[model samples]
Target: MRHYVAGGTEHGGGIGRLIGYILTAQPQSAHDQLVTDTRGARWSKLRSPPLLWAAMAVMVKDRLLAPDRVHHLHIAGRGSTARKVILGGLARGLGCTHVLHLHDFDYASDFLRRPPWQRRAIRALFRGADRVIVLGERDRSTASDLLGVPARSISVLHNAVPDPRQSGNATLDPPAPDAPARIVFLGQLGPRKGVPELLNALSHPAMASLNWTAVVAGDGPVDHYRAEAAQLGLSDRVTLPGWLDRAQTRALSESSDILALPSHAEGMAMAVLEGLAHGLAVVTTRVGAHEEILHDEETCRFVPVGDVEALARALADLVAHPETRAQLAMAGRDQYRNALSIEAYIGKLDAMHRSVSRGALRGASAQRGTV
Candidate 1:
C-alpha cells in the first residue's frame, strides 16, 4: 500500500524532522510506496498564502492520479484552519484513508474560541478522518470535546527520540558535587517556552547559593532573551549559543547534567524525550504528555508553570544533591527504554497504519453500496 506523509519541512520544527525520521525508518517492503509531501516555508520562515495553496494543489493532483494505489495519508500539523481545509479536501478528493496527527496543544483551545459556523467546519475536518492521533490521553479527550469526534476514534501516541545509548555517548557518570551543575534548554527562545520565567527563576535569591550554569540552545529572538538574562542579573550564569546542528545538539545533551524546559504548551516535546534517552535529570512544567511519562521527583522534577519560586527551588535542590540527580537520571533512562524509544513508537505507528487502511477500504465499499 502506498503511504504519503505530509507536514512541514523546516529543520528547527519538530514535526518536519519527525516525518523525515519516520520515512527513513520505513520497512524495505514499504519504502517503494512511501511518499513525502512537505508543506510550509523552508528554513522556518512564513510562506505566502498563495504559495501554500499552490503547493496543496500540486499534492492533491499527485494523489488523485494514483488514488487506488494510495492506501493511507498521514497528515501531521498543528491543526490551523488552513491545515484542516487541506486535510478535508485531500480525504474527499483522493478517496483514501487518512490520519490527523496533532503536534500542538493550542488547537483545541483555539477551536473553542472560534464562531459557530467555523467550529462546525473544523469538526467536519476531524470527522472525515479515519483516525485522529494525539500526543496524550489529555489531548485525546480535548480532541473529542473540541472536534466532536468520539474518544474511540482518537489514539494517544507520545513523541519519541532515537535512543542515546545507540550513540555510545550516553553519560553514565554521576554529576560531581564540586563542579557547577550544567543545565541545558533546547528549543526556541520565547514566552511560549517560559524563557522569561526561567530567567526570573535563575535570578531568585534561592538560586544564588546554587552553583549552576545554563546553556540556552536553539534560535529565535536570541538577542532579546540574552538581554533579558543580563537584565535579570544572570549574564555570568547563562550562555546563549544560538542554534546548533544535530551533532552539536547531541554533544551538548551528552555533556549536560540537567535538561530544562519550562514550556507553557506542547503536544510532547522532543527535547524532553531526548533528555530522557540521554539519562539527564529533567526539570520541566507538567504540560503536554510529560506527566504521563515522567514521575514528579522520580523520573524528573515537575514545577508549576510561571512559578519563579517553585522553579528556583527545584533547580537548587537538584544542584545541591547530586545523588538525587543520579537517581532521577537512571529512572528517566529506564522510562525511555520502556516507552519512548523510536523503535517502540514505530511499532505502534505500523499497527495504526494497517488499521486505518483496512477501515478506509470498508468505508469505500459502503459508499458504493449506498449509490
Candidate 2:
C-alpha cells in the first residue's frame, strides 16, 4: 500500500513532533510514509495561514489523483479541521481512504463548547473519515457521544515517543556534588501549557534554597514569558531558550533529572512520553490521558494545574531526594518499554491503515484509482 503522512513541521509542537517521529525515527517497514507539509512551506511565514492551508488541499488532491491505492493519514487539530473536512471529502471522491487522527489538547472544553455550527463541522469531518484515530479513551468517548461517530469507528491509541536510552553504568546519575539539579520543560511557552504557573512554581520559597536550574524550551512569546520569569525572580535559575533543535533536545533530555509540564489541558502530551522514553522523573498535571497510564507518585509525580504551590512541592521533593527521582525515572522507562514505545505505535497504525484501505476498495467502488 502507498502510505502518505501529512502534517505540520516537527518544531510546531506536540502533533507535529508525533508526525516527525513516525516519519524519521521508526524502523523501515512496509508502512513507510510519504510526507507532505500541511502547515505550509518553510517560507510560509510571509504568507497568510489560510493560503497555506489551501496549498495543503492542493497537495492532498494531487496524492488522491494518483493511480495507487492511497492511504492518507492526516494528523492535525483545532482550525485544521476546516481544511481536513474538505480533504476528507476529496479522498472519498477519488476512491482513496483517509484516516483522520484527531489530536487536540482542548477537546475537553474548547472543542465541545464551540457553537453549534462549529461542532457540526467537527462531526462532519469525523463522519467522512474511513477511520478515526483518537489519543485516548476520553477522546474516543467524546467522538462517539458528541460527534455522533460510532464507538467502533474510533480507535483509542495512546501517544508514544522514540526511546533515547543509552547503555552505561549510569544508574541514577545525578550531577556532581556542586552542580544543581536540572529541571526541563518541553512545550509551547503559552497560557494553555501553564508556562506562567511553572515560572511561579519555580520561584516559590520552597525552591529558594535548592541548588536547581530549569530550561523552559519551545517557541512562542519568548520575551513576554522571560519577563514574567524575571518578575518572579527566576531569571537567574530559569532559562527559556525558545525552541531547541533535535540534537539540543536530546542532549537536554539525556542530562535533565526532571521533566515538568503542569499543563491546564492535554491529549497525552508527547513531552511526558519523551520524558518516560529518556528515563527522566516526570512531574506533570492530572489532565488528559496522563491518568490513563501514569500512576501518581509511582511512574510519575502528578500535580494540579495552576497550583503553583503543588507544582513547587513536587519539584522540590524530586530535587531534594535523588532516590525518589531515580525510582520514578526507572518506573517511567519500564512503562515506556512496555506500552508507549514507537514500535508498538507504528504496528497498530500500519494495521489501521491496511484495514481502512481494504474497506475502501471493497465498498467505495464508484470512483477510479483506489482499486
The Cα error of candidate 2 at residue 24, in Å, is: 2.1
lDDT (Cα, tens digit) per residue for candidate 2, span 1-371: 33323335443456667767776665474254655554553346544355546644655565556544454555455546665666666666665567777777756566666778877767777877878888888888778887788877888889888777543423445568677889999987898888988998999999999989999998889999989998888888999999887778888888889999999989899989989988999999988889999999899999888999999999999999888998999998999999998878988987887888677667756465455
Per-residue accuracy of model 1 over 1-371 as CA lDDT, tens digit each: 44333344344277655655565555565544454443444443354354446545645665667554433444433434555566566666666566777667566677677778877776777777778888897778777876778877888888887876775666666555578989899998888898888888888898898888999998898999999899888899999989887778888998888898999998788889889988899999999788999999789999998888898888888888888988998999899999887878888887887887777678778888952
| Residues forming the 10-long window of minimal summed lDDT in candidate 2 | 1-10
The C-alpha local distance difference test score for the whole of candidate 1 amounts to: 0.75
Query: Which candidate has the highest lDDT of all?
Result: 2
- Residue 127 shift from truth in candidate 1, angstroms: 0.2
Candidate 1 regions exceeding 4 Å error are: 1-9, 24-38, 42-58, 61-79, 169-177, 366-371
Could you estimate the TM-score for every candidate?
A: 0.88, 0.88
lDDT scores in order:
0.75, 0.77
Model 1, C-alpha of 161: deviation from truth (Å): 1.0
- Structural RMSD, model 1: 3.1
The RMSD of every model to the true structure, in order and in angstroms, is 3.1, 3.5
Pairs that clash in candidate 1: none
